[model samples]
Target: MKNLYEKRIDQTKQILAPLGEIHTRPQFGGYGVLADNVMFGLFLQDELYLRATAQIEEVFHHHQMTRLRYIRRGLPLTLSYFQLTDAGWQDPTLFLQLATLALNGARQERAEKQNRERLKGLPNIGGYLESLLLDAGISNQEQLKAQGAKACYLKLDTDDIPLSIKVLYALEGAITGYHEAALPAEKRDELRSWYETRHPTATTKYRR
Candidate 1:
């Protein structure tokens, strides 16, 4: 026997099937209704809610949709999803149109999220080095590029963090998107010379 939630999921999937490949996955204490692998709607307590992006928020408002909210630890947390009103459920065409808007919003959000490049995603950058860079005021890839490898190394050096020629090579590799060991011989030699000049007795490799 299908439970109410499961039955509702089937119904929602049927209504949203026109948009393409409708499916549900466990999420946020309920099920997330996705169209073509993009999350655009949510199901909670047998109720449906559409994702409300900024541009389509006014449209949701026009339909008198209620935003999802729940109390946790005595604090109310309101989510960005708006309840799919009775009118939407009663009218298949309107429901599909609203769902299409939700799908577009979800795609835009995904695209924007993918555009946010992360420094840790770069070559030769691990959690420890990323933390050191963050402490030295370099956060994202854009900030890392702006600081450059040499300037970033100098910042770490000033912080009295035990760093070596390898650390410099690593930073350079990260900036240039190359493996640290694959740095050019000339670049390696150049960095080694710079390090020796800066610290005559420092021989420990980057704090691993």
Candidate 2:
């Protein structure tokens, strides 16, 4: 098994070395390469493959490379994986295109990771409600009022927020908390009191 793994790693290195530095590491019981600390591709059993995104899937299709598939429950599970054609590996331009796609995918993955990490540090409802408000174009209390409660409630409904008045109060609390200074003192206090009344223990607890 070790010799097989080493052979696969060596083959991957030989193929990718010319393009740029390829950093090999074990992942998912196979080997993956990180180009510039961003996973660009993988090697499985001496077969080299690049990461496939929606944008690059077409390129892989054009080159007649088979989409990677695995059997699950006696059914083929085919997703975004694409086998690099022999011509694609030899053609520097095509190799670069694949590399570019991988890099973009890595950037997006990293950004999402960072967002998740940031959310991990925040109160559960903080980011979620902020995102909801941002999606509704209600960055401040003034904007929320401009939209009116019905419009805001409708938008919240579209987002699957419950129609109950209690949920509306929670939503209002979230909005006010995020835009404290923008909200009137009385409205902010009212929302805070409503929230505390609903969940008295939440007043001092930081459950994230």
Candidate 3:
């Protein structure tokens, strides 16, 4: 006695099950399709729209896939999800391949988001630097401040992670809640002096 949308959800789940732990949950007047808990697809009115990142969007474009959009307050708002065409649905191999890419991309985006949250309130600490800090065992703002910028810089250097002297300023700024460019001249000079004392031969100029 399932409705058309309910039956479509079951069909969609079966098609995506090969990617592992496929499930659906109600979302934004539709159903969000999740692979192993990371949402990577959307189902609306029996049409499937796969989640997409910038990289995956290019692939979807190449396949002539259209992005999902809805009218909100008379304005059309396009989303990151790309529709799976009838041909795409008929081809299980291509469908799963794109679905897999979407799932991986979604997972990566989620991880980056979580990492940014973990390092929130730390100036100049975006995803790449956040990862570096996590790799060096400096996971959060409190840990970074407690260890001090010099120690954190040394930890990164010890791990053979090549970073500019600006990172040193960035860490200090993170502690003081100042933008790296806005760091006090004296503090900047002190940090530069410390760096010179440690690695005298280095010639990496400071840039914001």
Candidate 4:
């Protein structure tokens, strides 16, 4: 296996040299091909694979490129990397296009990972808020970002959980990844405006 891989690595480097500085390293039981610090291709199971994204997925599908399927932890898995089509392999210009699209997808994936990491560390958003978000069909930081603070707050209100002003600020805090009280004045005003619109004359009642 090692002997075969050394030859493939040399050939891949030569093929990609015209594009720019290409680097290869081992990861996930395969060798990754990187250009300008972004991995855009891979070698696995004696096949050359390229990263793919929705923007250029149709081109891959049109070529009928086989998707990489493997088994990990006894579970069948599929990755976005697809085998290089014969035409793309033969055409350096087309291969560069594919590699560019793949790098865009990699960057997006990296940004999403950072967002999820930030969400997990949110100060006031915990299991309770997560459940409320789930009930509101707004799971994950991506969804929370898309729905905006006001929309998520109103979605939770429909669940009849006896919420109040604190919950509004909490949603804003979750989106900001800070404690509820730490929100900026402009953001707090936006949340308060939305809350006042919904509850015109409600007073904060402890109901003790």
Candidate 5:
């Protein structure tokens, strides 16, 4: 079954070779062709489909070409695939356009997938920092400066806890801090003292 699929994939590449450079590799269930490392199309059961993007999607609509669906109840999938309109494979220009559209669509799809994956991996911060940042709409450092550190921290009780965690978060914010506001090395050192005080045991273990 695998060998048969490989043969069909090879044939699909051959059919597309004349149009331009076509790269074939195993993907999803069957085979995909990429132009410039961006997926332009795919082959399944020896049929070719091109990616569809917002701008050129209407071209696919006019011809009533089938939109490829990957996952149910997930993102909507669109592609520019068509069976040969005629017996001889006559429309070279149309083929090229469809292939280009597919490639662009695939690039967008891959980018969105990466963004979704990254958002899922955000670290958890305690309620104190979370509420401060959230209330200020400062999910990241860019927003941090606009809100100002002193104001942001005003709500939290500073006297009760050792200063280390606060300093560490500040240092982290400095390293990633946006263009508008960034903590200096001295401020980071002050935070470092808190870290040393709070995590002396753990710090010693790592130092060894």
Candidate 6:
């Protein structure tokens, strides 16, 4: 006989199938639901939890779903995962709607979190430079990438704070997810060219 949680896991898969292929793997105590390796749902005991964002969280509230909570290191921690109320289980159409919202939120959250972690590890993208980027409305490494390193560097109003070529190297490392020292010679040369042209006192110029 399948356990109650197991049956709920199966039912959750059925409800989520319309979204895409729902795969399951053993999680902490129950199962995690994934599509294309992206986590969108979680099953624990008799309840199912879905990702919640500021916007989609209202759906959980509308359905009277509670946020999922678990203990870690003897501390109660509540995550963005929210329980699906009876309304979610009884209606497959509603389930798919809520599931898609949850998945989108999860994808965005995961991406930002991954970018933040990556940025923290990057050379020249420490606390202060990150603050400058955020102040300039560049939130994450992905956004920094969309603007490109030179554009972002030029965006910084460094009238009091000295801007140098090294900051450019750091931004490149942040974008490529590698150390600035690992950057190719051509890329470094290109950065130097842009920097010299931008800096009023930079005497060097691109020979070509």
The residue ranges of model 3 lying beyond 4 angstroms of the native Cα positions read 1-3, 115-208
Cα RMSD of predicted structure 4: 15.1
TM-scores for every candidate against the unseen true structure? 0.55, 0.44, 0.54, 0.50, 0.40, 0.53
After superposition, candidate 2 runs with Cα above 4 Å error: 1-20, 72-75, 112-208
Candidate 2 C-alpha lDDT tens digits along 22-99: 787664335667776667676666665677666667877777878766543233434345666677656757766666
Model 4 lDDT, residue 64, Cα: 78
Candidate 1 accuracy as TM-score:
0.55
Q: Comparing candidate 1 with candidate 2, which one achieves the higher TM-score? A: 1
Query: Please, what are the lDDT tens digits per residue for candidate 1 over residues 17-76?
Result: 878999887655677788777778888898998987789999999999988877532335
Candidate 2: clashing pairs of residues: none
Clashes of each: 0, 0, 0, 0, 5, 0
**Which candidate tops lDDT?**
1
- lDDT string, candidate 3, 63-136, tens digits: 88999876532335456789988778788788888899999988887677556547755787877777667544
Instruction: Locate the minimum summed-lDDT window of 10 residues in model 3.
Output: 154-163
| Model 5 weakest lDDT span, ten residues long | 154-163
Candidate 1 error regions (>4 Å) = 1-3, 117-208
Off by over 4 Å in 4: 1-4, 107-208
lDDT of 6 at 203: 39
Against the true structure, candidate 2 has what lDDT?
0.54
lDDT tens per residue, model 6, 80-163: 678888877889888888889988876776577654744455566887878566534465666778877876765553343346
At residue 92, candidate 6 shows an lDDT of 83
Error of 5 at 102 (Å): 2.3
Q: Of the candidates numbered 1 and 2, which has the greater lDDT value?
A: 1
Using TM-score as the measure, the top candidate is 1
